[model samples]
Target: MPSSRSAPVARVSQETCNPAVCAPIAEDDKRALVDAVETFIFDCDGVIWKGDSLIEGVPETIAMLRDMGKRLIFVTNNSTKSRAGYLKKFLDLGLEITADEVFSSSFAAAAYLDSIDFPRDKKVYVVGETGILGASSSSHWPPYDRELDGVGIQHLGGESDGDKKVTLASGQLMEHDPDVAAVIVGFDRNVNYYKIQYATLCIRENPGCKFIATNMDAVTHLTDAQEWAGNGSMVGAIKGSTKREPFVVGKPAPFMLDYIANKFGIKKNQICMVGDRLDTDIMFGIDGGLRTLLVLSGVTSETELQSESNSIHPDHYTSKLADLLTVKK
Candidate 1:
């Protein structure tokens, strides 16, 4: 077993960004900043769109970046959707994004299991939506887009327990399947005590069972105008019960960062990560040794980015991703 602190990119992580240099990009230097990287990695929820609505200028800005021949990757902590589901979302918002361009935590969780050579006979217990099971309403996904299923790992207890309840009877006996080999906790709108208890049981009772979190984002933009409790809240329940932290596979973990770099055959320094949140998104880029840009259109605000107590800082701050195009030729 490896420590969660053993992230491969620890060289620059011990140091925080100097606030003096973390200032907004000057109008004259924006183009230079843009030109510094050949690849642009984006956080999907806040930086690209909010729930069902596309953020202002997102489509045009993405098109502009594409025209410049920049490699674009959309990394999302939201596990409620598979890569196929996210592609439908982009199309619904008129973004014209391909499925390959999107990388999601659900996929990361599966990727992690594959990396570890998880046994083909063992099964995973998922605490999330149908997306975690690779089962969604999108016509393109179904069995074909099933990530965990595709990897030869079967799963149980996702949306199936949405309507289930655990009545506190005088002698109610609860039981977990002995065959469950790992517990995967992701963002579930229908998360309940039943799901929490079930996941806790698997981690504590099952031998050598691994606890995995798709991500631990504190807040999520589930709707266009409000914040909802992120998957971190759900993972916290199991962690508190089992007294064990999960190996997160989402942003801030660099699992996807390393995956992206290897898949694209590019260098870490050649990539610039643009995201809104300080903890998950920005921290991910900072720890991965890639340039970071924080946008105000998401979870993080300008004050938070420049706070005295705040240690994490991005290379540049902007009101939105569209600001990258503000550079004058």
Candidate 2:
């Protein structure tokens, strides 16, 4: 297995903007910026909306861009919802978006599997919700019990009590199934000891089993609060247990851009990624060779951009996506 440390980091051009100082999107530059890009990739959560409410002026701005014949793509690192689920939110927010226009880390994960020709006969042991596997709600493991820590079904070749039995929620003693050929980790709100244990076992016990994660977002920006336990938190646990890293298929990794470019036949230089987060959204654009625009309406703040420790930067920054409204094509 390849070492995670050896994984290649995406390279940007030497002219890439300095991480410590981002240029403000001046009024004069807005028009040029708009004209230079053929497609706009938006980060949904903090840029277009916060929590359940749509961000102010997003609807009009999107419509205006669409009327201008510019392609629009919504890409999000949040794997909690599937693409179909996300489309419902867009419509509910009064945005006229189709299923193809929306892309989430969940869809990227599936696309990655398809690209690699993942075997149809093998099942994936998902440590997440329906977003990752598109399984029915009932197919998910029951709400995990905290008290079940360290209690796990034995792996193949592992010694167990002579009874060769493991008790389940239904009070039935069963043996472990070894059919799982991959372990997919994503955002699971009901995450507990069992899910982690099972995922770890699948990767460690199953030979040549793939390890995939939707995204490694450390925090999710929510209305009134920031949730620190994102999918990265869950993936970290599995990594620590198995000492094997997952092939993260979301932003900053290039899989999402690869999918969009292949499907739409859009050139990377003609795309602009607009989002609030520096790590996922902005970095994704930079990594993919697309122009990047940072908006202050989301996770990243102007103050944070000035920090010397900040390593990723967008080509331009604005107070909000509404700023684009001032730019005429």
Candidate 3:
């Protein structure tokens, strides 16, 4: 069995520290940063709207960017919604965005599976409700069917037996399915023992079963409140049970970047990623070799940036995305 010990922490060098890794985009350089970028990739939750409310000045700023002919792409680690669903949300929030302009971890996961020619006959056991079913569906690849396709697992918060093991209502041990060739995990609001148990079983019992995840985000910001358990929490449970790491297809993985670049035919250097979180958004930009801009509107703060010890640093820091409008060319 693989040791359950946590991975060793890497020491940060002075040159690799976040501050030394990238300099803040000074007022003088703000204009250049703004002028040089031909495309802007925005993170949805924090950078644009929080919860159901749209952030102030965001609509106008986006409009201005559109007027300037800058290609705007909304990339979110959020997997709860498909691209079509995201378009509905954008429209509901009074933002003018097309379906093609939106991309989510759900879409990325589906695209990845399709790229590798995932076995159409094999079923994917979904542990969450991130629109993965719809995103991965086609005429040949149909949506999840509990009997024909695969099962949707969710935690019902039931009591464990004497040995602290999960049992079905009938007091039977959870059985693994051989047909479940892949386990797809995402943000499952109803995550429970059953979900984790089946996911673990499919991966462990089934031969060559694939473990995949939309994103590894530990927490997500909603309105002014922070949601403690994100998709990462769910993925962690399966990893702990099976000692298996999932193939993450979201930000900081560069898979989305590759998808965007190939689909839009844009150069990496010509794009800039703007978001609030240092780990997902900022590190995503850095890993993709794109200019990164950190905003204080969402999860990360100036204090956090100053104290960050890792090599994940943004090329610029702004009070908000609206501040970019004030930058003069």
Candidate 4:
């Protein structure tokens, strides 16, 4: 794998403010930053919908952008939902989107491993749900003859898991597959002492192996509740135990941005990241050299914007996506 030590940190600022925001920006800046951007990456949950409900005006805004010949992709740090699941939700909500147009942290993680020429046929130990690692084929794991042959672990239960039988399956997987090459964690609801203990031991014994996560989001919302933990929490526990940091590949990561850039044949400067969370959405824009717009409707509240961290800052702020049409173009 490539040295992630050189990956640019995620931060946000007004580096790409529209020329209209000040004295006329140079034509090149406008062309590079605005006119050339034919693609827009939107963060799900906060930007488009909260849970299953669509934020007001999102559909119209998306439709307008689509009609204008702008390419759109929903980029999410949430790995709890698979591409098919996301596509189904979007369709259920009357939004026009396809699985191919959506990219998740899971996808980026796999791509990152692939970019560095990681062997394609190696076995991997996955500690998350199927959504994060249950693909027919993945770039993260070396290509092997077996499909899902490697040990699979689920750390926690989902919204319906409480009513189901099993919980804390990840610990069991660890017990079953101690010799796996890599360990991965995504979103789990049954995270407990056993899973953490097992994961810690695995990493401690295998320092040379890889540790990957689907995202860093700290919380997720269900129809009736908002009890969740971000992947960072897991990272923290492992780091605290092993004194080692794992490689993260998700939203705001250059790999995902690079993937989008290559997929659409668009320049990084021309892309706009529209998201509600400053850390993932806005920070991605800053680090990727793209435009950032913070929405008032998501996880990051206006009050949190007063903090000193540049990760929470955005190039532009708005209460809703509809406001973009009114941007002084």
lDDT of 3: 0.73
Candidate maximizing lDDT: 1
For model 1, the stretches where C-alpha displacement exceeds 4 angstroms are: 1-17, 141-144, 168-171
Worst ten in a row by lDDT for model 4:
1-10
Per-prediction backbone clash count? 0, 0, 1, 10
Off by over 4 Å in 2: 1-23, 135-174
How would you encode candidate 4's per-residue C-alpha lDDT over 1-329 as one tens digit per residue? 11221122223223433322322223343333334457888988778888778888888778877876788998887765566656667888999886678787765655666666555444455555555554435322232111132223222222222233325455553343445455666666555555556566667775466777766666665442574667777666667777876777786667788877887788765677888877777887778877667788877765566544433556566777765543223
How displaced is residue 124 in candidate 1, in Å? Answer: 0.3
- Give the Å error, residue 104, model 1: 1.0
lDDT of 2 by residue, 144-213 (tens): 1100111221122111121223346776533345777777788777777666677777888889988888
lDDT of each: 0.82, 0.73, 0.73, 0.62
RMSD of each: 4.9, 9.0, 8.7, 7.8
Candidate 1 overall lDDT versus native:
0.82
Compute each candidate's TM-score over C-alphas. Answer: 0.90, 0.82, 0.81, 0.74
Candidate achieving higher TM-score, 2 or 3: 2
Measured with C-alpha atoms, the lDDT of residue 240 in candidate 3 is 97
